[model samples]
Target: MSEKDTTNTSIEENVITLQTAQEWAARWRENPLNTVKAHLIPRVDINELLAEKYVVDIRAYIGVDDQGVNKLMLVGVDAAGNDLINASNGDYIYDFTQPCPNTCDVDSPLYTLKP
Candidate 1:
């Protein structure tokens, strides 16, 4: 499909925002399921979040509308936060693993990467 086709927001994305993703990222960070304990993956169902609600995974939400590099950065952090991707600050990091096919241009410092 063409890149323009991606602009069409899916029903799932309409229900979330960057803040929501960040909050979810925090929750994911606090949860024990993201890590290994007792030789098993902890139960994350207690989080009560859907696949789309996650900061990053097969689904992730960006801080901007449509597409842009800033979105990638935020989504990258969320991806990295979830340990699904690897990225750094001061650049537009790309992760082929992201389920979304959005790749936009971003040029600003406000788009901070998570340390």
Candidate 2:
């Protein structure tokens, strides 16, 4: 996947059309074995990562939990492509996102097929 330019990330630049968003969501939901539709990350956690020292971008990594469920591990990345979150500190990285299955907005087109 291509990375978005984070140098001057703006709300307008990040916003996607509804149809495009729905298409992406539908593709993910296409797989029968895919239980997790999407991850619901809180704005607070994102804000914290963005506010971190020398943080130029936030990177997301896939990880497996003890129960073998896939989860997203988020961290602040510097302009030098270095992870700003100290791995030595167990809680430095953010992984507080809740999966869409249990915490989804059912009315949204991303989660349901709207008529």
Best by lDDT: 2
Model 1 residue pairs with clashes:
none
Candidate 1 versus the native: TM-score?
0.22
Query: In angstroms, how far off is 106's CA in candidate 1?
Result: 38
lDDT by candidate, in order shown: 0.30, 0.58
Model 2: residue 68 alpha-carbon error in angstroms = 3.4
Residue lDDT tens for model 1, 39-94? 11112311212232333443333232233212222232244555322223221222
Q: What's the lDDT for residue 37 in model 1? A: 13
Tens digits of per-residue lDDT for model 2 on 1-115? 1132344554333333334434444554454476666777767567866886788898765544545444566667889998765544322566556666677787888778666
* lDDT for model 2: 0.58
Q: Candidate 2, after superposition: displacement of residue 60 in Å?
A: 0.8
Where is model 2 more than 4 Å wrong at Cα? Answer: 1-32, 88-91, 113-115
